[model samples]
Target: MRSDGTLSLERRRQEREEAKLLVLRKRGSRLAFEWGLQQCVKSVNATPRLLVYLLREVCVLAGRLARGGRV
Candidate 1:
C-alpha cells in the first residue's frame, strides 16, 4: 500500500525519501533556533558594552566639534 493506495517500489522509495527530508528539515530548524538563541544571549550580554562604547564615541565627536567652534 502506498500513499495513493497503489503498491509500487517507486512509491516506497519516494516515501522513504520524503520521510528523510522531513527529518532533516526538523533537525535543521532545531539547530537554527538554538543558534539564534545563543546569538540573542551573546548580544544581550554585550548590550552594556555596546552602550558604553557608543556613548564614548559620541562624547569624543562632540568634543572635536566644540574645539572647532561648531558646537
Candidate 2:
C-alpha cells in the first residue's frame, strides 16, 4: 500500500510538470503569432507610402527624359 501511494504521488508530480510545459508552449506560440501579425500589419501600412514615393520618383525621371536632360 505504501508503494502504491508513492507511485501515485510521483505520477501526480509528473502530470503537473507536463501541464506546466504545455502552458508554456502555448504561451510561446501565441507570442510568436502576435509578433508575426504585428510585423505584417506594419508592412501593410507602410506599403502605400512606399508606392507613392516610387511613383513620384518615376514621374521625376519621366519628366527629365521628356526634357532631354541627359537622364
Candidate 3:
C-alpha cells in the first residue's frame, strides 16, 4: 500500500497533466480561429478586383450605346 505522502504526490502529478492537456486544447482552438480569420481576410481582399472588372464592362457597354451600336 502507498503511504500518504506518496499518494499526495501522485495526485499532484495527475493534476499537472490535466492542466497541461487543457493548455494544449486552448492553443489548438486559438490557432484554428486565427486560420479562419485569415481566410476571411483573403476573400475580402478579392472584392475590389471583382468590382473593378464589372465597372469596366459597364463602361464598355455604355460606350457602344453612345456610338449607336447594339448592346
* TM-score leader: 3
In candidate 1, stretches whose alpha carbon ends up further than 4 angstroms from where it belongs are 1-46, 69-71
Better of 1 and 2 by TM-score: 2
Models, CA RMSD each: 19.5, 20.9, 21.7
CA lDDT for candidate 3? 0.51
Q: Per-residue lDDT of 1-71 in model 1, one digit per residue for the tens? A: 76887878755654554454446446764443344344346655433333443455457658878899542
RMSD of 3: 21.7
By TM-score, highest first, what's the ranking?
A: 3, 2, 1
Q: Estimate each model's TM-score.
A: 0.32, 0.35, 0.35
CA lDDT for candidate 2: 0.50
Q: Which stretches of candidate 3 lie over 4 Å from their true place?
A: 1-46
Better of 1 and 2 by lDDT: 1
Q: Model 2, stretches more than 4 Å misplaced?
A: 1-46
Clash count (model 3, backbone only): 0
